[model samples]
Target: MKRDPPPPPPQPFFFFWGPPTPRGRGGGGGGGEKKKNFFCFFFFFFFFFFFFIWKRRGPPPFFFFGARTRTPPSPPPAPAS
Candidate 1:
């Protein structure tokens, strides 16, 4: 006897190729909200990042200890008699 054909694969939760439909309003609304939240997160992240850099008056410090230090210049040699 011939075996039965396999059942079709289940569909994915979201589809990109289909035309927009009124029935998909809920899903589309959720996507729009997610996009808005992503933008807000990045906006605040960059705002704080720049604020820290500006307060330090230079590039952000490394993960190690305090800000970098500079060595003082040597005193000029005394004039010969």
Candidate 2:
């Protein structure tokens, strides 16, 4: 007697853009994974970039805690004549 082949795996739910591709030795669905990785990298790059700017330059003037009036430095008194 002969046995039947196993059923294919269920489709993953996260992919909304298109139908699932057939899995094979060449690695199906690799393109979607690259897109996801790119998005993740982009988000983290901006996150760290803004965080670095904030650390180096402090908060923007519009922020409540950063809002402060500027004052000119006072002139030094003249030396005794």
Candidate 3:
């Protein structure tokens, strides 16, 4: 005999509340395959930095690690006699 149609998929426990957010609880795909906030932040920072370096010859001397070179101040003018 022909079998009846399979049962419908199970409804989400809290699906009635909202569609679903990326921040949903575990197993919610929150940590399954999606990227974390830290990664996104890092990605954006590097992306912006890449564009900034391209736009402006490289990061300012201050943003570098280790001691950086400082701009030399103008020499004092010679005293008038």
* TM-score of each model, in listed order: 0.36, 0.41, 0.29
lDDT by residue (6-76, candidate 3, tens digit) is 53343356332323445443233343224345557789999998888868885556657635676689999
Per-residue lDDT of model 1, residues 1-81, tens digit only = 997555333333433322333333123322434545666899999999988987888655663455565568999999999
Q: Candidate 3 at 6: error in angstroms?
A: 33
| CA lDDT scores, all candidates in order | 0.54, 0.60, 0.56
Question: Which stretches in model 3 have alpha-carbon errors above 4 Å?
Answer: 1-35, 58-81
Better of 1 and 2 by lDDT: 2
Superior candidate under lDDT, 2 versus 3: 2
Ranking by lDDT: 2, 3, 1
Score candidate 2 by lDDT.
0.60
What local lDDT does model 3 show for residue 48?
93
Estimate, for each residue in 1-81, the C-alpha lDDT of model 2 and write its tens digit: 986555344445544333544432112343556656777899999889878988999765765764564778999999999
